[model samples]
Target: MTADDYVEQASEIFVLSDSFIRIRELIDDEASTIDDISEVILLDPALAGTVLKLANSPFFNYPGKIDTISKAVLVLGITEVYNLVIAYFTTEAFKKINANQAYLDDFWIKSIDCALLMKFLGTSLGIVHAERLFILGLLHNLGELVVHQLTLEKHTACESNDINLLPWHKQQDILGFTFGECSAGLLKEWQLPYNIFAAIRDQDIDDLSQYNVETQLLYIAKRVMSKNQVFKGQSLDYSSLVTKEQLELLCLDKNMLENAVDYCDLERLSLLAILNPRASMLY
Candidate 1:
């Protein structure tokens, strides 16, 4: 297999919902009115239920209950509502297969932790379109989900005792790509915005010349999220992967990084409980 092979396979992975595709198209076209967006959202009953649940969740902290999609949109702002909708739609993209439940849970927990931290850091830095930044953070690792799914059949062949040593990326390499590369390709095929594609692709390391401040913030946030002591085993050092010049370009500092981690730690636990109450209870 080659990079092209992996890209082709990734492109073939069916998105489960046509409504999701339409919603992405509408938002990308800059749907301006609540009515216009609401009409699209109401097409999916599951999505409508999620929007209402999210609006009333502690994340939003609405004083009163929100019953209608239109009211939820009004209270949450279109950008926020859009972000929440996407988050809900995409949250289930990763599901545990025969992989160790503990490992899968931990991976998702870290992903959510990193995403929330990125969102907080982006907002605190006064980045324009912070909500989009949050969405990027949330969806940045979706490529990993794709890779895991694509290779599931192969992965199951490993002896149970040998599973830990399976070298996941080698499978990707054999299949001719990395999940990051495959994911970026998928995002491009999906026609998502340039910022999102750039954020995920460049997240491996900082390249000041290619990406702007917004993209750089994502790089920093991913690193910070990875380094959380909870994910110490999987964390990579951004300083080594990124150049000093790139760090200087982004105006990154230890203080902001620390603040982001502290905020994400609290919020991620809450989000986990909200998103997967049963798993939260068990773990």
Candidate 2:
């Protein structure tokens, strides 16, 4: 099927929460207050529970407990609370699918880790609207889900557990397009930001000089998370993985990359647990 066909099928494949749309709009409004966000969230008990659980989780690193949704928004900031809720919602987007449980778990863990790292990296670089990167990173690989679902229908022989080749490469071979291209189509369908669309479309650029720093940062964040998941034993040698010009372009030195690795190491587990609580309990 063509890219348009894939996107068209995606709308029917996943059901987005209406409250998510309202919360997204509410957070974007300049005059929005914590109460407004709380009210929107309180409309859905599931969303409210997710927010409160995460707010009290060690991931937030807050001392006292955060009981109310309003206080969660106030302490976590509107953007953060919004990102967490949306990110969690995205995690639940594809339940009751016939994919390998292990593969599905890795896909989400890596997505959340990369998105969190993107936010952290964005803040260090003083990039505005960094919270958007959370969704950007979370949804960056959504096209893969579309393709996986299509594959499940016997459209192709792509197995969810298959890892002989990278996912994007396999997608390119099977669907004649990379997940990046597919994600671009889906993001456009959702009417997300132009910068996010551009960044994901170019997140894998090998020629770092051609793209902006934001894309490069995403590439780095994705690579770091992938390495952490796929390479737990060995050390990450950025001297070889990251080019000198790329590092210089992004104003990132060895120290920053190392620090990010350390941060990932410390936070990756807690984050996986908090973000995938159900799966966390199983494993």
Candidate 3:
């Protein structure tokens, strides 16, 4: 099946709950207030609890307690809160997808690694709404799951386990499109923000000049996660994978990238505990 076919099939099966839809509508409406969004969030106890947990989690590092949805909205801002809500619900929506648990676990770990790195790096660069970058990194590779669900036979062939061979090229060779593009297609179908989907759509490209800063940041984060030898229990090397020009584009140097990777290592486990249902079960 093609990318669109897989996306269409996945959308039919993996559906977002109505509460999230309502929350999106509320965020879009100019008349909606914190209490208005909080009222809708309160109707879903699990979501509300998750929101509070994330507000208190190291993700935000807020000092005081964010005990209520209204307060969470106030502290996290409506857009950041919406970013978290969608990130939460999107993961929840795909929790039970038919795939090997081990494979899925690895996929999610790498995704969270990329996400935390993106958030850290974006924030370091003073980008607004860096939380959305986290969501972008988290959701970037979901098309792999979609493909695994729809066309199980092709899924294994799509993996580029070798550090030298980029996964997107492998996917393009096998599936006629990169998983990033397929992921973007799925997000577009869900009516997500244009920037979110578009960045994912072009993240794997060689050229970074045409895309926005968010997309460039995502591209860098993805490369770090992809080429991370340390994550695979090997020695580190960025000399070949990340170019000097790329680092300069973001006004970042090798040390900052190293710090971002270290930051991800520090934060990945905690964030995964909150985001990954399978991992959360262990706690």
- Measured by lDDT, the strongest candidate is 3
**TM-score, per-candidate, Cα-based:** 0.77, 0.80, 0.94
Give the per-residue Cα lDDT of candidate 2 at 39.
Answer: 98
User: What lDDT tens digits, residue by residue, belong to model 1 across residues 1-283?
Assistant: 4545655676665343677777766766754577878998998877888778777865555699899999987877877887777677566444433356765666567667767777677777777646556677767666666656667654344212222342223444355444555566667776666766777776654355676766677666665664553336654544533356755676666677677777776666567775555456544
Error of 3 at 158 (Å): 1.0
As a whole number from 0 to 100, the lDDT of residue 156 in candidate 3 is 80
* Per-residue alpha-carbon lDDT of candidate 2 for residues 113-167, written as tens digits (9 for 90 to 100): 7777776777678887565566677777777777777766533443332234544
Which clashing pairs does model 2 show?
none
Error of 3 at 229 (Å): 6.5
After superposition, candidate 3 runs with Cα above 4 Å error: 229-231, 234-236, 280-283
| Index of the highest-TM-score prediction | 3
Runs of candidate 2 exceeding 4 Å displacement: 28-33, 62-65, 123-132, 152-170, 210-212, 231-236, 239-241, 281-283
lDDT of 2 at 248: 81
Off by over 4 Å in 1: 28-33, 56-67, 96-100, 152-177, 229-245
**Residue pairs of candidate 1 with colliding backbone atoms:** none
